[model samples]
Target: MSTQPAPASRPFSIMPPPPPPVPLPVRARSFALVGTFTASVFLSAFLLFLVQPMFGKMVLPLLGGSPAVWNTCMLFFQAALLGGYLYAHLSTQKLGVRAQVGLHVGLLAVTALLLPISVAGRSPEGSDAPIPWLLGTMLLTVGPPFFVLAGTGPLLQRWFAHSGHRNAADPYPLYAASNLGSMLSLFAYPALMEPRMRLAGQSAAWAMGFGALALLIAGAAAWVWRPVPPSAERADAVPADAPALSHSRTSVPWRERGIWTFLAFVPSAMLLALTTYITTDLSPVPLLWVLPLALYLLTFTLAFARRPPLPHEHMLWLQPPVLMVVVLLLLSGFVEEAVAAIPVHLAGLFVTGMVCHGELARRRPAVRHLTEFYLWISVGGVLGGIFNVLVAPVVFNNVYEYALSIGLACLARPWPQERRGWRGQAMMAVRTVAVTAALLYIGANSKDMNPGLLMASAAALMLLLTLALARTPLWLALCLGTVMMYSTVKAIREPGVLLAERSFYGRFKVVEFGIIERFHVLRHGSTLHGAQSLRNPRDPITYYLPHGPVGQIFAATAPRAGRRKVAVVGLGTGTTAAYARAGEEWTFYEIDPHVVRMATDRRYFTYLPDSPAKTRIELGDARLSLARASEPKYDMIVLDAFSSDAIPVHLLTREAMGTYLDRLAPGGVIAIHISNRYLDLEPVVAALVRERGLAARVSSGPDGKRKRYESIATWITVARTEEDLVIVAADRRWKPLTDRRVPPWTDDYSSLLSVFEW
Candidate 1:
């Protein structure tokens, strides 16, 4: 028998009886498969998020650096993401696995032609519909590529579930990886990429990354490719006792999908609402929008993680108190500083996101319905964006969407499955009504009371009510809704508020506030943009007061001869026109048409009409409009543009300085109003002036002891020669801007974080 066996094996002797083939360890193979899918998903998310701020920055100057640019971009992205998820769901359900992979790869290849990304068109000239224009521009510029990228996470994870891996039964952890990539990218762009690379370089690098991702995606497709059906592959790879697979055969109900949507909606809405609230009301830092988004993505990461750092129950426990604290902050005017407000608002958002997204994760469907699950979640995200960007601006004034989302999040919290009896429900209803009445009463009566005392009392009562109702999500939501309603009503009924309007740029309020003399104040968030005296209608008050830095700038820059021509970048209440002399020409460049309307409306302000000079308003982004201006025509160029309290960073960069120099008349001076409550812009201006080989003087205007109407201001005047700025330089109050050795901001690279007062 041995001789027979040896004779039979003699055919292999030439190959020396090749050693038995070694098989990879099961655990090693499983990890390798999981990592490939995870990394593909991660790269998809990283590229998706990196493009947001990079492209937003590219388009920021077109929109005058309005924080709304970022909001609108978020909306666009959400909508695109929805479209992508829809495609993923339909394709996966309707097509074979190979067909799905082929279609997606083809789409990716096509979208590659659109990169490196850019803003497609100049914002339509004098276009009144900035939101529509921005949406259109973004759609044309990056829509295809972004939509392709947005779908990669869901599609790849779905593929992974069918990939015949041991852990294929549960692929949700890959979603955590996806969002982790998003969070890291958002942080990296601002801290590393932005400071080091110009926008152009970032775009190019992003394009190359996309190419690598495409190859990796192909590799993933190859790894999962099978001649057998996906069902057969899963049957061969996974065990019968796999927990996730037990529910894989069940169909998700419409009701379950609706719950998934609602759970996703609150956090999605809160992301944009919180971003708008922070950048609009607190600080308009250059990359400020990234924080809300990163936190938003982080919640997704934690909620879906295999082993979350923060437990789901813990998040639920933390949510109510955080919401109550946020409500108190909203009612009270405390925490106005960005350093404090940012963390407070971000914490609220994080907790709310945790509760909502954690619920979504808990209720996540089996691997078979993964694509459908993502589709519904994306629907909620898009709806949230629409509510904040489209619906809120139309339905309610200010950022009530933020408060509304908070209430919705309250409702999304896990509720008792058992229904309460009629008596219990009635009692809960009565208690809610009583709480509502009390909150409304306190808010209505707040005007005459000491504001701090009133806010304290109301906040205390609301906190107590919320804590009591925390066990019942429905009742807690009702109480939170009541609190928000009271806050909104109080704001609407606030004393001296004449007109409150919202635009794509920001919220604008015209109010009459004065004891001895009435003044019409144009307010943007907490910042006083400009004010006009009803007693002396032609006088420039607020930041433009006769004794303020702006006033000093006007006095120093006035031409000695006839027919001086001037250009003002920002047209806030047209206040700079107050210094105009007869026979002079003044052109105002304003980004928001609403601002132009408010400034020209005699009922609110009269600076432009009352000016003795010939005044004309130019409606567009100042940078774009100035690029079209007649070179060297302006005797003086005044940069007074602001997006709420923060000046548009583009206006303070070296490139902007060069534009001003190009537009300057011989011996002309560039006067920049650098006043800000949150940023140290003097250093930024000093850097710009030094880079341009120009002389400059900076003035921190009169002290707080000055006239009530004279708001403290800071201004910097830059000139080609010292003689051009001699008048300002001679004044002790206006000191030469010594180089602070700060890096000069360029169009390609600028970080508000670098210049942030914090």
Candidate 2:
């Protein structure tokens, strides 16, 4: 009994001993391999997205700050991405693993030579085809580097799959990692990088990152390379759940590839269409461009995640309701304020993108066809960019492409797997027509009915129709299409619009308003650019009304010497020309040709023709046009470009201030119209002025209660010294800016967040 008790002695610890440590060599090798590939991919994507906004910012000064500039940049990026995907597909298909590694490593080294990207050439002067010019310039600037980086995602994942690792069977999670990098870069640019760093600093840092990425890529290549036969490697890499066909030998069906492309197209198009719609229809909030693109990249991360938190089925079920709410908001015109409209539209875009991209993840082909799958997806993205950038502007007068894309996204939603009988189809058709007809009735009688009641009725009908046709994608698409058509048509054909034109710059309309006074207004989006009295065309109205801040600026700066010369950066209806006096010379720099045409048409505006000064119009971006000017100096420079609310950031940087100072005559003043609904630009201008050791005075006009045509305005006048601004500084309404410091914006860096009103 004593011996038995001795045998039952307890162990020293409760826990079992740890298994033998992974062999140090094996552990280090594995860690190095996995870490190298992941870091390389992450760095590549980070560099890829960072270059977009960086290069876009550089290009904006050449082109005016039209939202189209971003859209055009997106087109170029997509096209380059497509080319990269094609290269990846072909190279992987034709070459062995070792050969692929050598080829890719060489590519990274070559692309490194083009590091620290910058715009290559000046925009052609007076070129009507800015799109081509922009695309060509970008091609020379960032194309090779972007193309190589774009291929890193698929290429690295393919390499990892053949590495003979335990987790090689399923390599899709790396795609989520890739997109994660992209999303972070987008957020970082606006939040951290732009606010803290200069453009030159950012570029240098990006170049350093590229160098590190090349080294990482070389490590990944060395880890994956093998002397074994290609067939043996492919056989070893085949996943247990994958089909028997070797990825190397198998050919994906064209129909499947097409399905992949169609799934990808809707979301890609929606990304741009929604961005344009938001910036065009709502407030052009600073850095708002990133929100849509960030959401766009986020969908890819979620869709390809190892375990998606929100399942594809959930997005499918959730999209219709969100889409219906967006339709209601658009139709009712209730959510006009940027605070409300922005979140609503952004949510809609996120949900819609999730559905499309989720479907893409679900349908992704075997590892063997990975590059091909990405190639088709890239094709879809390029097509989307082309549609929105090139085709939509010519085909539709308004932002009709945005609505069209929404309808198309509805069609892209998963249809019922079970075929519908004729009775089911007939029922769907009946419900669609009923909802569409009700919408039409509401639109037709909108003026006669109380807006709230009409909106309520339309919302109820749309909700009912959405639920009724939830299982039928085609009918749901048709109903939404009808709603969009009617709503947009009504908005476009408002009673007062005499002329409506669309260009890459923006939508422009000459709207007749004020029955008693009879005025024609030049409107861009929701902001009034300039307006003229039909009875007295030479009288400035709206933001430039006599007695307003701008009027005060002109009065204060009126020439006391012989033949003063004036330069106007933006020529909205040429309203500032009304301030010109006899023997004075005026030059107007206008970016949009359409605006120039309307301003000079005498029928719509006579401010320039009626002015007594020797006035001339120059068509181009203001900064570039001004740089090319032969004039030695300008007595007064007026900045009137901010009224449309898309503040051309390039025009407000410290370098821009230097340009203005260079062109300014001794004792000359610079007048900037800073009246804005969303941005407190006086602070920005003040910061710039103080940075240059200049004096500035700000005029905040009264509420214009005395005249219907006059509008409340704000203008800031800057000069080399306080004495130069004495004329405005003496007025009670014009306050001298304090020397309090805020971060000054330079050519390398600017943050809309710094000056955002809210």
Candidate 3:
């Protein structure tokens, strides 16, 4: 097989392609392609992100109007993208440019059939395997669309290279431009797109632009043959003896396949983890999820720009340990509730990303090899996707991707220059001893060690670690780093102890807000899953609150032994189980194993009365559990699966309602917590009731002992019998919920802006 083919020989170019093995013009067209290719990449990248928030809004309701739905979808998308990149690499290495374009165009055509984005019907699903179902539906629904878009950056880089663009301006700055486009999409979705457009309008707009992109892609293919012809000597070409480009003179660093995997795996994992940390801590909106990422992309732009290099390029050095500290915080129950707690985590994530991207950019080959360079980045990206979305859930409890990513980051990182002297060795000994002693002292002390004081100790130890890393043996520092890191997580991660963190495809961590105050934070990617009081000793008033949806449902109906087969979808401190009355049967369908352990563990959910009554906990998706319940006819069904931003949307579709109604007594009430920070859920509830022929009403107001942080919440109760809903909301305050005032979120139709208060 020949390395190069003249276009005439290939039958496409107006002029004959260059002779066999025509060399890339490393300097000539490099500047020109930077602008045009950058613009093209920019446009495509812009559209790629724009669609995320747009489509997220469309499907908000079927997933319970929980912002977590979007985050989960993000995980799916990232995984699909990895698939796309893999396909691109395998096909393009041997396929000619014309064939690549032809193949990519075919994919675009196939995906175009999915345009004018719309979901079938909006209702939660009844499936024991909602996550897998959700993942499958999302991948199938958007796969073709995503695969074609995902190939843009790499393909354009190839085109720029084939144009024989030979300059420092070649592919790198275009990459900066490409990311700038990504930044715009991240920023624009929340600030501009959603606020201004409806789901249909947004979909239409994206579709229009996608049509344009297809044309531009075709145009780009047409332009690849300009300025050179097959078998012709180009007089403007520089001889091989000419000075090489400045950026091209640097030696290529040796790369192992594992190293490439590390680069990709570390940053992408950190990205998803940060997505979890922020969405869990901050508000759930496209804005929240996109902000830190924008910062990350901006770092790439600044790092590669002519701007003076700050201490940024080396920030990755401290990341592994930083990651360890964050993980330890998760383990130790140290997360604070304030928004301020989020920025530090975001900063750490940004630092990790910067180091990875900066290293990639720094080691990038000359423009001649731009195609190959991006191919590796894509490789790293794809591996990261698999590691985070596909592998992490099965490999560890909770999202340890952050810690794992940090570990890999260290492995991929360039080692520090070694110094062999007594001072160095002595300093090493002091640092090593200090970290070890701290670990032992803190670990063994148990109850005596105050977490705050311990945190301070950890910080001091990390600072010492960083300082030592700067001057000592890399291996010794890393050794201490790993141990200290593990110790920190052990101290903080009370997974099965005081804090009952559910481990799975989520982050459900409980951190001590104060000595006697524990705050349980739940997460789905970058969104908060849920939070509630970790009742001290026996404070059932705040924890049990006889008026909350579940509390009211069970307390009112349980004493009568009215509903023996009650099913609760989510397990939150098992507070709902506190309403258990004698002879009443209750089963909780919870997905996270950590949450199950926390619920069943003697240390947590004590009020739940371990093995009390007929209460049973089922481990699986709530929808599936509900669907399988044949005629035990639950007198009360609580849909708690949409706990927080970690929304599993496939659980809440029109089809899902049929499953629940089928298992309900004629008058049984289904109270859905329509509480969300992003999407206005009332409209979706209204639409569901409208289509399913059920009566629904909105219940509101904070009935609990209000605190400084009493969040205003709303609920929608749908019933087979209309009177039951009124009975549930009778003593409650309610405002008329209108179709226009709220977003009519369906499985196929949801938008945050439709209901967001300006």
Candidate 4:
């Protein structure tokens, strides 16, 4: 290559002469750009997270009672994010600066065409298997905006890198600023935007921001781009239209691209795992998904800060041991819900993040390839998000996202290899052998395990002092030590003591919270069954309490009136199955493996009285299960299959309703619980009914204990045929639900947000 004086010293080509120096110091400009970008990030991502919970809340009513769909949507989002990242990469690679700007603006214009981005239709034709299709619909509806929004981080960073005005030494700080903005968004949106702004207002505000973004993006592009100068471009500077280079430093800390991949994988997986764990154990408050994400976003903030971050001290000291213990414990299922274990979980993540991010900073590429390096990081993240969200659900029946997270966490942290001398090796070899023997002995006898002893023994002997006296390969010793420590068996294989239960298209496993922390059970994903209420496992009334709503509805439609057949859509722990009387025939439909086990395996459902109806558990999708049932059979149909935000919108479609009505006996009552924190589902119910010319009413607030429940769930009871339900009968407690009848939803008409906060 010919000598081109420094890139900073000469023009690239036929580009215009550089503008005279402006009054703003380059430092100030850098700060403003970073700060404004950060602020924009907060605004953009805040809406992103805010909308996730809010929209989920909006649609909860339409999908049968399944919270698992939330996870499904999250998976979809991650997949789309990857798609967006790949798109950004492709755009930057194929287009010149001017074209790239034009392409982005064009995408913005197309996305704007989808404005007032509210779901307005009802009656999805293919709702027979609606989860996947509705997912596609929502994504297409929201894609244009999100795609442009996603390009912000990568595109802006690229712009700053090639600006040719500031010290290129640290344009990376802008990335940190971006995450900071995003973190603030995660916190502010739920706490502020949603609870306050109506959907139209929210949509309007986002549209305004989009317009401003377009203007800023145009301005920024105009500030930096120019035709290449023939002399300098001829000399050896990169072409004005050169592809972003993917280069690495010689002494990059991890050295392997695989390690970077591992680094990227662990944090994202942890975020998802913690989100699931909390939703499972603590709460599925869709908005709570934000907490782990906030922590993750904030980690990027600290790791990529302008200087040594706040985590440096804690990272150097406590993060290692905490990470080690948490990894071992998590791998062993000692601290299952990273959500319930927030204090320790956050601490471990914080420490591990410090080391991990510090390494990322340490190994950062030369300023020339900074943008490309981040591109790879985002690529890895998108991959992780895909694995956790897109692939995991179809693969495992139970929540194993947490297990993968533990493995990745360990992978992110390297071993302390300094002590791997000679004797240290011998000690490790002996320890490995001893631990193997102990494991074998325990396995042979098949008895109690002393997890504490095994862990302590490994820690005591593997400490650096012992290693100093002994020559060993520290990496190998630690590897064996990790195996030995991780090998310790758990005291209890099953954590939750079964309580009041129901199963939906989600997992409703509740654990004994314990004194000082009273135990409360929560559901996380889609399971076509029910839950175990800790409300005296011996008490069936909590679920099918003869004094409850089902009990009351059955009473009002008195046996004297005629024979009343019943169809319970979800048979979780089969709590509702107990509500069946001698003359009354009931069919229970359940769809999860774990739920089937909990209900009839003799391990969990000991409270149910043995009878012909007790054995009537049907395993499959509730809609399918109900569709297969005899038509015109049941007087009371309970729609509790989807009870959380991760819901399948198909169950509430007009076609599903037609199916329910076709299957219902005259004067039937359908009880649907619409309790959710993030979405306003009543509107969806209203839309569905309005489409069908049916009447409805709602019952809000907790049935009994609110704190024990965490979030309040609503019940929107509907009728297939008209009969006076002057009062709702709930467990000898006759609480009056809404009396103002609402409309029935039809396939040609259902919009969840349509009935929200109007």
Give me the displacement of residue 680 in model 4, in angstroms. 14
Indicate the residue-level lDDT of 276 in model 2: 75
In candidate 1, stretches whose alpha carbon ends up further than 4 angstroms from where it belongs are: 1-29, 61-72, 106-115, 118-141, 226-250, 283-286, 333-342, 433-468, 557-562, 741-744
The candidate that achieves the highest lDDT relative to the unseen native structure: 1
The lowest-lDDT stretch of 10 consecutive residues in candidate 2 is 1-10
| TM-score top scorer | 2
lDDT of 4 by residue, 1-758 (tens): 22222222111123233322112123324555544444554455554554565455444444543455566666666666666666766766676556776777678677778875666564356445768665876677666677667676666665554554344334566667767767876666555665456555666676777677666666566544644222211111232211111123222234445556667777776677667656665444544566677778887888777675474434544443454444444444444354445666666666656656655654455443444556567667877777766666656445555655654554554444344578856766676566434433433332245767665643653353223322222433354344434443332235554432333333455455466544344334422123334445544433344444455555666752334577777665566655555556777776676566666654445444443342366666677657655654777778766544533455776678787888876667777755454556666666667667676666544356533323334566777434445444333343334322333443323334333433
Give the clash count for each candidate: 0, 1, 46, 75
RMSD of each: 10.3, 9.3, 9.0, 9.8
Per-model TM against the reference: 0.86, 0.88, 0.70, 0.68
Query: Which has the better TM-score: candidate 1, or candidate 3?
Result: 1
Once fitted onto the true fold, the runs of candidate 4 whose alpha carbons sit more than 4 angstroms away are: 1-68, 91-99, 128-132, 135-139, 197-201, 226-255, 282-286, 311-314, 324-340, 390-404, 414-419, 427-542, 545-562, 581-634, 639-758
Q: What is the C-alpha lDDT of each candidate?
A: 0.78, 0.77, 0.58, 0.54
Write candidate 1's Cα lDDT for 515-578 as tens digits. Answer: 8888888878767788888888877777787787878877776554347889999898888888
Q: Hey, what RMSD does candidate 4 come out at?
A: 9.8
Worst 10 residues of 1 by lDDT: 1-10
Error of 3 at 99 (Å): 5.9
Give Cα distance to truth, residue 624, candidate 4, Å. 9.8
